[model samples]
Target: MNCRKVQYYLSTFSEGSFSSDKLSEVEVHIRNCKSCEREKFILEEILVAVRSLPTKTTPDDFNLKLFNRIYAEQNNPSESYLPTPESSWIRRPIGWVSALATVAVAALITMVFLQRPVGSPDLPLNSPAYSQVESTSPVSTPSGKHVGNRIPVSAYENIIGVSGSASNYRATNVSQVRTLRLADARVESLYVEMMRRLGAEPYPNMLRADTRYYEMRSPFARTGSNGSPLLRNAASTISY
Candidate 1:
């Protein structure tokens, strides 16, 4: 028999539960194997120590204390299992970071939508009105005069008319002019409002402290120089 068989039968040998033939085989192995003899001695020592240990009894109030703790935890879970202030400090900053990131993303999306072009098929680039509006750049007026950052003369003409025609025009022609002027005023107001909404200054002169041109300008005024409050309100409310 090997040392493995001797160790396996060690417990049965102590209890005298092995047959005579198996006992002879385990004894032969243990007598020849010094390691198996040492293992058997250690197992005997462990059994003796276990038998000598005093029995420990539960305290009379042990069950009552355990139940009370469970009940208290159930009734006031937060107070019983609240995290430390240091752990809360670590978590609060992460929540604030997430909120700030969300706000930044929303702001970026708003900016992108506002900055997107408001062009459409009705306002195609080749259209005369579109070309005229684009050609009326801030470089020069229709009267061949250089006026830096001033409203274009074409825009002014479209709204009010060329100079010296206001008094000579007939009543029938005046009515037609008024209609055109109102339309032009609405367009200019819509442009200015769009620029303002997108966080831009359409004309730098309008922002000047000493400049009263914004109020005097027909297109910029509440009325299109015709005292039309309804037209002014409609212009102001134009959407992109």
Candidate 2:
């Protein structure tokens, strides 16, 4: 409220140590009182001047020179490296408990690492029977309904009916067609053949076969005031 209190709070305010309550009180006093308002303005100007002051970097050899002097003092038996009575408390051991705790943690970590196996855990993905089938069979499918150089059983129904839907969907994501799986190579060839049969313009990237996931780009996502999609491309699934 007074000049003394305001002066005491000035340093705290600069350090950002003032609570909301104290800040509110200071604001109220500064608003009502002309002298306090002038003091606050002066403090603000002081802060700006302090912040604008050119910062000087320490000399490169500063630490080297300081440590050299300390080492020289330590080597000389006649000269005492011990702290004076005024600063003796600082030289006394204080953090033995913290040092012991750090040592314990390091020891535990070392022990655990030494006990660990050399290689990563081999967690097999499929059963032994499935793996045997995968190794021996020419074509692989989990359902065991091999088409003998033909399409998979589940994909049989989709083959004939896919021409129109594939055309529409492929048109929408022609640029990203490179992300189809190796098995989808047959699908790509089929698409090309169907396009020729149906007298349709073939998509440039339609028959691309690179083993990767399809990255979907949606047009119906929400936008900001500027009309750009609020969310960028994200890994999401669509049931349909």
lDDT, candidate 2, 62-180, per-residue tens: 54344434434533524765754534433546546544654565465445445543221111224232232233334423354342442232232233222212222333343323222
Candidate 1, 1-240: lDDT as tens digits = 777778888998977788999988888888888999999899999999999999998765454344445435533556777554434543687767755764565465445435544431123345343343455455443455465543443443332221112212222233345533433334444344434443444543322210122223233244345544434453344332
Q: How accurate is candidate 2 locally (lDDT)?
A: 0.40
Top lDDT prediction, candidate number: 1
Locate the minimum summed-lDDT window of 10 residues in model 1. Answer: 160-169
| Candidate 2 Cα outliers beyond 4 Å, as residue runs | 1-16, 19-22, 79-240
- Lowest-scoring 10 consecutive residues by lDDT in candidate 2? 231-240
Query: Highest TM-score, which number?
Result: 2
Off by over 4 Å in 1: 60-240
How accurate locally is residue 146 in candidate 1, as Cα lDDT from 0 to 100? Answer: 61
